[model samples]
Target chain A: MAGNTTPTDFGNPVINWIDKRLPVFTMMQKEYGVFPTPRNFNYLWNFGAIAMVMLMVMIASGLVLAMHYTADTKLSFNVVERIMRDVDYGWLVRYIHMNGASMFFIAVYVHIFRGLYYGSYKQPRELLWILGVLILLLMMATAFMGYVLPWGQMSFWGATVITNLFSAIPLIGDTIVTWLWGGFSVDNPTLTRFFALHFLLPFVILGVVFLHIAALHVSGSNNPLGIEPKSDKDTVPFSPYYTVKDLFGVCVFLIIYAAFVFYAPNYMGHPDNYTPANPMVTPPHIVPEWYFLPFYAILRSFTIDIVIPFTDIIIISSKLGGVLLMFGSIAMMFILPWLDTSPVRSARFRPLYQKFFWLHLAVCITLGFMGAKPPEGIYTVISQICTFLYFAHYLIVLPLLNKYEKPLPLPPSIHEAILAQKK
Target chain B: MGNPHSHGAQCSHDAPQKHGQEECPDNGHDESKRDFIFISAASMAAVGTGVVAWPFVATLGPAKDTLALSTTEIDLSPIQEGQAVTVMWRGKPVFIRRRTAQDIELARKVDGDATAFNSLRDKQKDTDRVKQSTFGGKEMPQWLVMVGVCTHLGCVPMGQKPTDMRGDFDGWFCPCHGSHYDSAGRIRKGPAPHNLAVPTYTFLSENRIRIG
Candidate 1:
């Protein structure tokens, strides 16, 4: 019930009669039609819309893929191959979904980074940001369980390795792990459960995304200038302006995504995944999908067990340590608003923070690069350093910068900022 | 006030909380009864919800069919000396290595290496890793029986085949990670938190073994 929106009579009597009872059209007009949005958002802002499009793309493709897929370990891999080779345009649907994951992640990462750069996590938007993080986590879980549906080598092994992480707990760890597997190993039970969950969690992500949008609406959209809209001049209606811009952005994004799907379908996929899962045979190297590389690197970085000094008391075994660090990397986002302590929302005003932001991005890329390599020799060393830096960016760098770095004066309003930029 | 239809909306709206309130005395009996009913309803609803949720949670655990394939019997006669053969048991691989004299010696030689034993991720003695099998009515610790999966991430190690590299320790090496095992299946190096697991097994005769 926005103050700006009112019941409007369309030319038809049926529409007017229905609107009086349901008010759905009224909601659409309020939320999407006449909603006030910041006027001067960059191309990066388009990613949120792009992510929404990809989500729908993934869901549609995945629904079709699920119909053809067999989750039984014996037939799953062959089922996937059959879908690709035999079914009408099944290859197209499968490829769209396969690349849709990477596309979705690409859009989401940019959306997240845009949020971070603009301090979208600050103030009244803490819950909004938290909701976004929750969606990310759900997406990660959905993506992970989805990866296991094919019952290919990577699917089986990836499921095995990731699920085994829970076994590092002190007591009942093995029991919990057994419960996770639904047996002694990642067999039919695990695959079936993963399939069910893979189907379930996307809907969960979609629900959280609804909450994310609801929260964003409550706070109003954060812009590049990081200033509140002081007047009508600073904002535009959501209808034609953003709807058209977002459509164009989606078009541009689809071209790149489509190229990968058609020309280089297997570019992001591991070659070993083509082979059916063999409980008796193991692939030489087991790497997770690229979106998870940074965290995977963090998972592998803790090689030495932490011992309490002078007591010969071994606490926090290396396995547990690695698991903690890997999870902690993501948990950092949940508490990021409190950690930064900066008044300025946008990095444009904080030169020092902006520099560190690039460094943080570099550290993440380094972690991703090192994650692809085996956890041995120089790779582990690099991973360790990058992992440490990745955490430090939130824990140390941002907080310290908040205290020391001098921020330039924030413009009085979004409108003024745009006017000044034009000058 | 005369028309009952006029008050129908209010009556229905307040019915649950104010049921029979107008006729009741100002005593606490009705309130207490309401409380009792509320608590009972809540408790029953909770129990009902929990009862409904039990099967959904149960479905996620191991099904009966998966749990049924608990034991595997192998004909040991076909397994050659110095060769490791993998057999399916409980949806996992069980490795049975027919040890040659040198393989036994190589394993036993390291038994006395205290420094080497200390390096094991999950320490187990060579004698502990193998069991006696009959040959001409004489018992020998010849067959090394263990679960074939690597303890790190459960990838089956690569030394089962004749051509596969068994790592520096002359034992199975995990192809997924680099966990090395000795001839006795003791984890010597890499990310594996434990030695290759020795499953419960017994020799039925000279040529048959039952593994679970």
Candidate 2:
């Protein structure tokens, strides 16, 4: 009895440490109230809270990885191997970080699309949405640089190919390449620089996320109906309502994240990366990660050269065309709030707009899928058609539909919409 | 919380307030009910999708047996003089080359080499010193072996011939960046800050060797 009691007494410090450090259970009551979240919030509002949880998961796993990782080009790859092999549960930590990245992206994309679907970008909330977009771009940059640190064949060659793209600029392209490389080529300097940047950018993204949330809090959230709450009657406390919903979403997201961590870790990784970088032999096909495939497909799409008259200039290389199209795809999103001028906020109230919205979504997904596929005869033709439709839906159909479509009358309130549905 | 306007007996005649109060109570009850149904439905969908996403997520971890084979012992017997072969150790490229007379002479000679192979004199001396101290002069370089990774940007440097225009030093040249190195695998010129790392190895015989 004394032995067990003494052990429990000794464990008091650890328990006390955790209680003082986190205070999760107690703070959950004070700051959030017993059920703190705004009562009227729908499922769309859960994403922000879900994103916060993912950030914590990523940071915790990432810190564990950093403890074991060696940043040097020579030992970095080997060190990763050691961690996976020698360290207890190192593979679990690595899997969490890897899948955490994917899940983070998945959550962010949904959050952004939810904003788009609801016209949350309009007026007072524009800055909030824009900040979110900035966060996304920074996240992509951070992930891209991080992927190259492993010193695998793909990591090496991928860095080379991407850094070389700066050479596409006129006149000072070579200088830019050299400046980026810090030597004649991508070598130790490049690796060190990339590692430094990768370490730094995540913090920058964190800062931006803070700003995003601040902006969100100021403007409040747009609901499914895209209408602001008029009074206390329309609003609900944010704590209990949103906290519970977010918790549910998080548990569900983790289940999927766990599956990927355990079973098919290499499904997203290229086989060539298992081999260390070899300058003598180039892989048969150089491809970026799957996320970049759509843009890569667009870059490879054009076959014909558009020649400039008199000067004997050839314009529009397939690579350049594809690059332009990629930028065009993202730039199109900036104008969406304006392009989608339908009076009604919800798709439920606008039949024609809903049809076009679904069609556009399908086209985007198809284009992304096509982009991942090899640029063979049939795939190329299909991709081109999908690509054309992707742009056409935004540039042509949206503007035309905004002008012509008549939307059903919006219900007076959330309560009204619900009651009307019941009737 | 009673409203002052509705407290008076005369105000009880107002139909608007009576109707509003009647509807207000139902409104809270109605909204909560709707929220419950929506939240439950959404939760169910999220769970279903999450279940489906498991296999894709599980692929992110390393193989279960990977830790057992983390450290490997490689035999170096079949490597002939003036020949090289690559082997993977700890998931990195490890190149093993038997040095020829020409290779040794070129590596030692410091001057007139356009790429300045002499820059490695201090580095080579230091490595030699460390090897001597650690192994009591047991392991000397009759063979050259190293990780092929360029210290910069991680590109694999191509093996350079003596006549290559990038530099006269004949070890490897990285096409991605114009780094040059000597036959001893010392970085001579380029963006790379250090020489290629030499792995730990021991010769069992003139032909046989062991690397861990």
Candidate 3:
């Protein structure tokens, strides 16, 4: 049976169709070189390729899930359960899709931090990095909206509370909330809109990713040295070099991803979500998804209540502070390329900067942890300190240290750096 | 630098074999090509193994028969008149409700002619007798049982009380999308396209009943 086909026969309809419609292999050869890529790319570079693979996996699994899914609010949850229990290979598809979301975020976080460490956002690559950040935001939104479609208790109340956050705005807040809900409350109209947006945003992220890649291609990848290739002699073909590396990385990633899907599918899920949505009984503590915990913490940190001058309206002081801090965190990243005055590029060459960067990362993670926990007295105090440090690292220390700290001598080449380190 | 192709050169070939070195041009090309072929073959094998293993890994849970039989029967004894109880059958929700006088009256008065029983009889003449055996011949149905899953999405439909606008439903209200079903679990209003399914069942006694 296998003898009928040659390696280049391309008898498979998919292979034949691809060959006819596009120059996939040729493009791979030309742009990547027949064996394209820098020979020395490290694990940090693996995430982008891993993310692409994850995107494909998520889309494939999600498509299968959508086939068995009922968009109607009443049956949506049950249909999801059916997909988990009844349809052929449905459980596999659902687990993959669900875990794929978590894996996507994991890869993306690592990808973003890799860019940060290598200063991939410097100079011409800033726009590419910014676009990547936008893609991250869009992804968060898509995941949030998709989570609500299950229509479980958490899905419903989470949607209701999150959508109601718009009411925190001034005069138009209530109107905006109503418009978002497509009704006076979170009902069928809200579910329909959430579904539509969830379906639509992935394509938006895809388009943004295209632009992100376009930007990356123009600048090329930043190496650990953060120096441009001096000549063709310095650069290697991308294909066999990076492709094999990326494939290995993907295999390792899949092992971890599979463990989560098979062993603890509900580890990241909220327990209250198992119950059906009951609008009358609010869940004791309303928390967003794990990914959104940091921001949720930031939103809850303020303790004051502010009354509009000469008006009866009163607003919680902490929520406003939290909102500002959240925006500040993201907005700070946009200005990072200009904020630091250090002559050095990579974090490896900047000892003080590296220390501060690690400290800031720790603070962000601590804030995220505190966000998920209830705001008791001690937790509140710790969150306040961490939140303060998170802002201080970006707003004050980074800029000031950039001027004062003396960076280490730069290596002319990665090869020289490695040799020097060995000696 | 040592000759690139010297049989025992100390300079490693792991580095990109530089040209204009002692190595023969043809030998360098052949070596690289061989490396490419080996790497490609290894990658293909790994990918093939992954693809084959995915299904088995995903299906590590119980077998089909075990999962099917995991469904447990629920008792409907405590369900008072005008009350409903939700039970699990085949991992999907099944609702059992006992109808009140007004519910039966409203169901009978629905199209002015009370011909639903006749229509049901006409549709399943052979199965009618067997199906009717459970309900018996009381003028009012003391109990109504159905899968709580919405025909549209499978949400558990809430039992609407007789007095509330939802209670006027005489059956159940699915809050997920506002689909309403009548006393007989027939889709009455909203987006549900099919009637709520009734599971295979046998009543053990008056109050105690078993559902499969």
Q: lDDT tens digits, residues A18-38, model 1? A: 887777788887889989999
After superposition, candidate 1 runs with Cα above 4 Å error = A2-5, A308-314, B1-48, B100-106, B132-139
Per residue, candidate 3 scores C-alpha lDDT tens digits across A1-423 of 123322343457787567455646444445565433444578989999889888888777877777777767788888888888899988888878877898998899889888777788888777887898899888988998999888888888778656755665656865676567654446666777688778788889889988997777777778887776665555677766776788999999999999999998788778887787655434546667787887766655654445587653555433345556676778777777777656677898888888888887888788889887765567777877887887787779978987899888887776666667789
Q: What is the DockQ for all candidates, taken in turn?
A: 0.48, 0.03, 0.01
Q: State fnat for each of the candidate structures.
A: 0.58, 0.05, 0.00
Among incorrect, acceptable, medium and high, the docking class of model 3 is incorrect
Score chain A of each prediction against the true chain A by TM-score and list the results: 0.98, 0.86, 0.90
| Ranking of candidates on lDDT, top first | 1, 3, 2
For residues A1-423, write the lDDT of model 2, one tens digit per residue. Answer: 122221122246766465455554344343455322233556766677777777778778877887787677788788878888999999889878877777787787778767766667877776787778778778878777877877787877888767765554546855776667655445566777787788778888889888887676677767787666665555566655666677988888888778888987777768887777654554545567776666655554553434485543546533345456766777777666677776667676777877877887777677778766655568778878888887898899888978988887776776566557689
Q: Of the candidates shown, which would achieve the greatest DockQ relative to the real structure?
A: 1
Interface RMSD of 3: 16.5
Candidate 1 chain B, run of 10 with poorest lDDT: B1-10
Residue B178 displacement (Å), model 2: 25
The full ranking of all candidates by DockQ, starting with the best, is: 1, 2, 3
